[model samples]
Target: MPRALLRPVWRTLPRRALVAAAAAGLLLAAVPRMQSGPPDPQLGLFALRAAALAFGLGLAFLLDDPARHLTTAVPVRRPVRIGLRVALVLPWAVLCWTTALLLVPAPARPPAGDLTLEAAATAVLALTAAALMTRRTLITEPGVMTSTWLLCTAAAAYLLLPHDRTLLVTPDDPRWQTTHTHWALLLAAATAVGLRACTDPVRARLRPRLSS
Candidate 1:
């Protein structure tokens, strides 16, 4: 029965759309590199950021359900339905990130574990944001809303946040472990919030979209 329910849900998923967007980021990372010149870690770091940002942006669209109203009447629970979509996307996410890592030059690339953790946290944060917005505002078009907020938050974090040893890990940053610890905490908090967003509400709540 669950498998049967997923058929329609999977059909509506924007798998190709997300993959295409992520592929563009991978291209930015892989292409435009000087094959003959010396490896510049900064450029590699930029590529990594590009790929990570693109992946996170793609993830922001994961919770979007234009037909959500139609599904509200369906017998399946909302959390279950949302979980199915996430399950379907996990393999694709793995493939996309793996491809992105393989495309980068080994020498120029930051430590794979650290970069991967950052990517995971970013993706989770995107998911968390979408889930939060959906529960709070009940937007059918959460993608556009989440994407905008995510970019602004990211930009602010990078530009406005004061530089300290306890910041996000950069290419040559000495506080790699400390930064990743913060990332770990972030991942945990986001995951917890996302779960709460999926909980069954006391009332049948479907708030209007942000624009409304």
Candidate 2:
């Protein structure tokens, strides 16, 4: 990004949400080491799930800006502005995930690949919710509203499923493969929705009607 645009972009970032994201990473990274005894398998699973939820909550609010209305009116296109915001946060997200994974001892950490996929899906869904709320709902504060929805939806997906077809299956579980297929689909769909939300709304330019 150009230096001139950097200030404006940084000013528009959702600082509170970003802070929450960092805190989540810290918590995730620290939890495993805090336990005194040998690694507990159940605790490891719970930790991974907790991390995913926290990351999602943090990411869901990334688009929130109290000045969203004012920023929308700027000459810069909506996609450019939104993309800049997403780009700015991408590095932190990557770093946070990496740190969280590395902090957990190798034996205690959950299956890295599956857990990472779950985390990725959650993050994208959060972004999708934020984008939809920002552009579609036209809300002044988008994060809280969308974050609540994300949590509820995740809970529902887990509780509403049958015992044999759970969404939170462990890697060793028989349903693991199927569960991750759903996650992959979710990631793809959420990304498409976010992209659409970031795009500038098409303005219909009306032409003067001529008398026949």
Candidate 3:
């Protein structure tokens, strides 16, 4: 049953769409660099990569619904189908992250040490998003999942990157003070809203009974 569902979901969106969108985002992000400004080119590239991840994830969620499309021909179990969908989506997320890391310029200063905190935070955020995608109930609310994922990723990026006192300029700076305070607040607010929608006890109680 799950296999049956998996086949169509995988085939629903063309690979071209994913690649095109990712590329377009990257190009747009590079615009800042093209102009003669002192913008953090690395940060702009990271933003592009983040956008790609969001786009790919959004496509996966949009196409994963069994109700909108037929699943009778598929031969996989529900759990298996969910697993397969997650497996498929995982690569896209990884690709986005890798692209962002690669495009962004390396730190100007010598490495202070391993970005352990940032790495751990990223791992946590990725796992959380993947878990949400695997759960049938969670995937239904794409907005919540997207918001949660973005918030977590942003937080992780802030914590993981090296901090130079000079580099800490704008709210967009990927350092401790600016990122930890401004971006954290934005992401936290988003996470709170997403969590409220997903885990609201009153809504959860009513949702299952109503659906039944």
Candidate 4:
């Protein structure tokens, strides 16, 4: 496939699709349980987090114009550009993943604290990955700053909802186990995607242009 189309096809679209799939899967998984009665707070939280993940990934894809470098005539430096790009994407990624971490229900049974140190480590890794990808993409196309801000705002609103709080640091409810597992999986996927996006060879060739 042409390099022009490769980014959207491989990186942007696929990531967006993956986010959608994850969200759908979570909702579907929770459906059967909902038939029993009102939706469990834990399950609701999982669904919301999954949706937020999808939105976050989508924002990254939208802000990144994979084809821009191909069209621009200016000769931009690669390293500086890449650094700025990383800086831009990082905040959104961190916001999304951290919010997700805060929103995911924790297990009741733990060795000591409410959340294990291992879990915190995992969360940090996930947040870092998400931030890297998002920053890189946004920095590549600063024109989308307004959109990025909107996304950030929306994510924050979702995270701050009353029900969302119940998901975080809630009592030891059995329903939370499933939600916790899904959160871990989501975090892992975000981390993997972030790493791949940052290391893509195409970025080296794109070069960075200084903001006006």
Candidate 5:
């Protein structure tokens, strides 16, 4: 059943948004490499973070199905359908991030594991927000609103979050480990919430039971 849905789900994805974001992210990641002299570690970090943010912005569109209302009756469960979409896109997203990492000069690269965690957290947060919007509201296309919210929150975090407690810390900072702890926590929380939000509505689930 899932195999059959793959083609259709692939077709439904917001390809334009995804492609644009990937391109933008790759370009940003390449910025450090374009310098005339040896790359700066801090600059590499910034470029990678920007790339992650761009990818997360595109992930905000993952749940947008204009035919969402029409497909409620399909035998495939909502979570399964959502999972399929993620499965389809995961390889590409991973590939892009990998390329982004490689674009940075080895000397300038930050700890890959930690930075990868940050990217994962950002991406999951975006998806969770989109799932929440879809589950809670009548909006068929929640991507733009979710993406905008994520962008604003990122900006605010950069401008307003305190140095001691901020997630945007450098590897040399004492807070680096603590910041990634927060990232892990965020990834866990978003995963839990996103799973819940992807569930079929209670009414939808109860329809057959009530009918019987």
Candidate 6:
């Protein structure tokens, strides 16, 4: 069943959106390299963060299936299908992110480890929100809405979050460690919620039990 799903699932993925987003991310990451003079460290951080946001926006569409209603009756479970899609795209996303990182000049680069954590957290948050919308609503394509919410939430956090609990602190700031600690927590929470949202519905769960 898993092997059979590979072809159809691959065909259904939002390839154009993902590809475009990846290109945008790589382009943004390369912005620092394109500078005429010494690359500014602040610009490096902004570029990387922007790249990460672009990647997350693409991921916001990961679970969208135009034929979602048709596929609801498939013997395969919801989580299985969702997991398969994620598994297929995960490697490509990672490669794109890595390339984005590499595009930044070393002298201008921010701490790679910290920036990677921020990117991971951002991506997972997008995925979690997408999954939740798919699970709870009738909308087959929530990418636009999800991406909008992600951006709005990011902007709000940036503007409203208190200094001690901020997530966008600079490498030299005292809050750097505290910020990443929050990021780690956010990643864990988002992962948990996303997994839950991808689960089979209540009726589906009871069907096998009732049959047996």
lDDT of 2 by residue, 1-212 (tens): 44456688888787887788678766976687789989866677777778778888988777877787776656576677777877898898888887888778777888888888989988988888888777776686788888899889878877897877677887678888888898898789889988998776544111112221
Quote model 2's TM-score: 0.88
Candidate 1 worst ten-residue window by lDDT: 202-211
Please identify which of the two predictions, 2 or 3, would achieve the higher TM-score against the true structure: 2
Alpha carbon lDDT of residue 156, candidate 6? 85
TM-score of every prediction relative to native = 0.90, 0.88, 0.43, 0.31, 0.97, 0.95
- The ten-residue window of minimal lDDT in model 6 covers 163-172
- Model 4 quality (TM-score): 0.31
lDDT of 5 at 201: 86
Answer with 1 or 2, whichever has the higher TM-score: 1
Query: Model 6: residues >4 Å from true position, as ranges?
Result: 207-212
lDDT of 2: 0.78
User: Pick by TM-score: which candidate is best?
Assistant: 5
- Candidate 3: C-alpha RMSD to true structure equals 8.7
Clashing pairs in 6: none
lDDT tens readout by residue for model 5, 88-157: 9999999999999999999889999999999999999999999999888989889999999999999999
Query: Which residue runs does candidate 2 get wrong by more than 4 Å?
Result: 1-3, 203-212
The sequence of per-residue lDDT tens digits that candidate 3 reaches over residues 25-127 is 4564444445564656455544543454445434433323535223422434333544465567667646754554444444311121222223223333443
TM-score order of candidates, best first? Answer: 5, 6, 1, 2, 3, 4
Where is model 1 more than 4 Å wrong at Cα?
A: 31-36, 205-212
Compared with the true structure, model 1 gives a TM-score of: 0.90
Tell me how far candidate 6 lies from the true structure as C-alpha RMSD in angstroms: 1.6
